[model samples]
Target: MTSFADLDLADVEEVAERREELLAAVRDHAGRIAYHIARVDGGDYGQRSFSTDDGEWTVKYEAGDLEYLRFEPRGGGETYVISTQQPAEPKALAEALEDYPAFVAAYNDYVDSLAGMLDSVEASFPQVESTESVVTERDRIVEAIEACCDRMAGELRRYEGTEYGSFAARIDGTRWELKWDEDGASYLRAGGSGGVYVLSQYGPPSAADVREYAPRFGGFVDAYNDHVAELELDLETITFET
Candidate 1:
């Protein structure tokens, strides 16, 4: 339900202002942007480091000099994709790291801004009636569900000669049910549990009948499908096939 615009990963700024942080940010991006030590003070670039949303990470590297540092990246938790290498320029390395404090801070903030925006977007559209744009979309899915119910009820009504029917979305724990009786339609019901919720067709009473008229529920299927098609959700689409 969340959109990309709602996230603001760009809102982050580098917070590292210490000598160690400068060295760390350099090492983190070093693989992509190569660097190595010229001075003998740090001793063979073993403690590679960089800044992240929460703080910093310094992976202990091998005690060897790097002539051609390759960008071997690692995961940055939920915030960044990090990597490290030791280039052969102490002055340039220190300069880069010195500048890195602001750069890393700004860079991380940018990414965080986007993440924040996405978070905001998702928070806005939590359910069926959450968005105005999705109102008509809901109508379409409801129409499909009603159509399915009608088809199901038709079989029951034709044989049993009574008025009772239902339609629903079958998620693992959320079973939203729509029903109708002789007194007309009733309020919709949304069920939640740890139980499995699979999309399945009911009624028709017998397997032979289900095989015969199962195609009739396609309209309801389309209604639910179209409702999702309208939203262009990024997570997973409404996958209901019964």
Candidate 2:
């Protein structure tokens, strides 16, 4: 809850000097340092991180207050975290630096482990085959589905009268329906239950609508075929008769 203004000016100056000293020490040891700061809760929060051949060091602060100083060694050893209400002292910083070499070694080992994991995963994958034949087979099935729909639509059109009429068929245990109204507007439904899907909203279903919707119906047919194939049952293609 302490604000920056509550701190004495001289004390703040001393802390700033110590911070610069710590940064200089880090740069001298690591040859490189990264510092970042952002506004947080109407105050400034910042972090400085630098790496040595041994490990990494991170210093975090809120305004001028030291939040925590952390040192994580490379590879995998114990992480040291120091938290104090006041800024870190020179002795504490020097002690943390002693573990830097261990940290670096641990980190390198971690990287090697990750590389080994990736190599193992890559080895487990089977060789992929060309997809051209798969795509051609899919196109062939879709064309056949479209043809079935077209034949069903043609048969529905041949039914006389504005009165309601419908034709039903069973393919692979699934019932399909093509129903028409007095106006000749047609609907198609798959399965014994569930509402019919209107092929044409404004008018009777057209050859164009059937062609456009064939791919969607082909998806259903494909899934059905896959289900039956998995059960070791014969795959059945949808067919219609007048």
Candidate 3:
């Protein structure tokens, strides 16, 4: 995965060209998969199970978006990019279509590689019986961050009419509002300037609760920073210049 810290748009033109090509290829490949689904399911975007050498393979696409491709044995697989339509800009769309063949060949190679891995993996780690849904550490972390952000939003709602420190409620647009909790934790909610916020409790400097929460708060900030790095998003600037 690309990180925000490692992302540099110095070669914007070249990168954009490659991105369009990749997207176009995925869209075309999706159409080919849809063709196979049409034989039985009439090409509708839904799950279709087919027989493979190892076992059954299930492909699913919802609302024209490719969701997942899972094979038998360990029920392991990978998800593909979502594609609905071509870009409105003609030149960019043309660039993507031009690299369609390259994308298809690469995608085929990836599928073949995954199939080989699955065959080997089945011999190495047999499937365990379980009725419970598996929750990974990554999933838990993502959920925690989401819950924290939601709490921040709730705080904004709870204290929108109140004042806190130098921050005041300011509505920029229909859904964009800036406010802070009663405890002085400021928040920029909705619109383009959105981010997670947490309260800083009002009390004496040496308060016991404050000291305890300080490190936890730092951890929360670090988690957000990690998420930003994982996504390769520019926390300071929200724009993509062409």
Candidate 4:
């Protein structure tokens, strides 16, 4: 997502309040304290784009004297903010130690949480890595996909000769052709899983008004062809569910 150093304070004008607090703390501590704002890159901020619609937000404080904190509302309300500086309040020996330990612990937890968020965001929406894993995984998925396409060819022909049968095939992420007949013709497609299956009459209708009762065709295809404007799967695992 975004990098730590790359974060712009002006972009998150809302944090001006905390910035004011950090500034006051820096001034109060003066030469005894060192304050530099470090950005909150990677992790929660980047993985999940903050939303102004929902009310979920998180405050991530920076380590050391550079008191940085970010308020992120990735759920709905302007998600995620980050900044750096020292602890805002003076502490007695016990409180100072407690605060220091607490800060350290919180920072560590933030780091861990950020790591998990990175993993989750990656899982939900994968990033095309440009490193070594890129080529290796790409090749792996490509070979698997190629083998699948090859199989589809023969499988397609088998269905072609079958009597009034159907199959589902994907074209990118957009559309799928619910095909029938030895000759290419009509198909059904949708957006994602169980989106909507609309029949387009390319050839003859296997059974006219097929949608009236059930999706019937001479061949099979993914119900969501039109929705697959582009192919997003760098790695695809295909299993004939039905």
Q: Across residues 91-200, which tens digit of lDDT does each residue of candidate 4 receive? A: 11112222232333444555566555555454456676665654555445434433443444445556355634454554343434344444432334444455444434
Q: Which of the two, 2 or 3, has more lDDT? A: 2
Q: Which residue runs of candidate 4 sit more than 4 Å off their true CA positions?
A: 1-39, 42-94, 120-242
Query: What range of 10 consecutive residues in model 2 has the weakest lDDT sum?
Result: 32-41
Determine the C-alpha RMSD for candidate 4 after optimal superposition of all C-alphas. 21.3
Between prediction 1 and prediction 2, the one with superior TM-score is 2
lDDT of 3 by residue, 1-242 (tens): 12122325566676566556655655566656755454445555687554433344455766554665443432443223333433333333333334334444444554565555545444556678762333343334434434564555454445344444222222332132334444433443333344322232231222332333333543444443464464455545667789
Query: Count of backbone clashes for each model?
Result: 34, 12, 2, 55
1 versus 3: better lDDT goes to: 3
Once fitted onto the true fold, the runs of candidate 3 whose alpha carbons sit more than 4 angstroms away are: 1-9, 48-59, 62-80, 84-242
**Whole-model lDDT values for every prediction:** 0.41, 0.51, 0.44, 0.35
Residue 224, model 2: Cα distance from true site in angstroms? 19
Q: Pick the candidate with the highest lDDT.
A: 2
Write candidate 1's Cα lDDT for 137-232 as tens digits: 544555554565555445434544567766566544345554557644342344534322222233112333233323444544555466445545
lDDT of 2 at 91: 40
RMSD of each: 23.4, 15.0, 26.1, 21.3
Error of 2 at 49 (Å): 16
Q: What count of clashes does model 4 give?
A: 55
What is the TM-score of candidate 2? 0.34
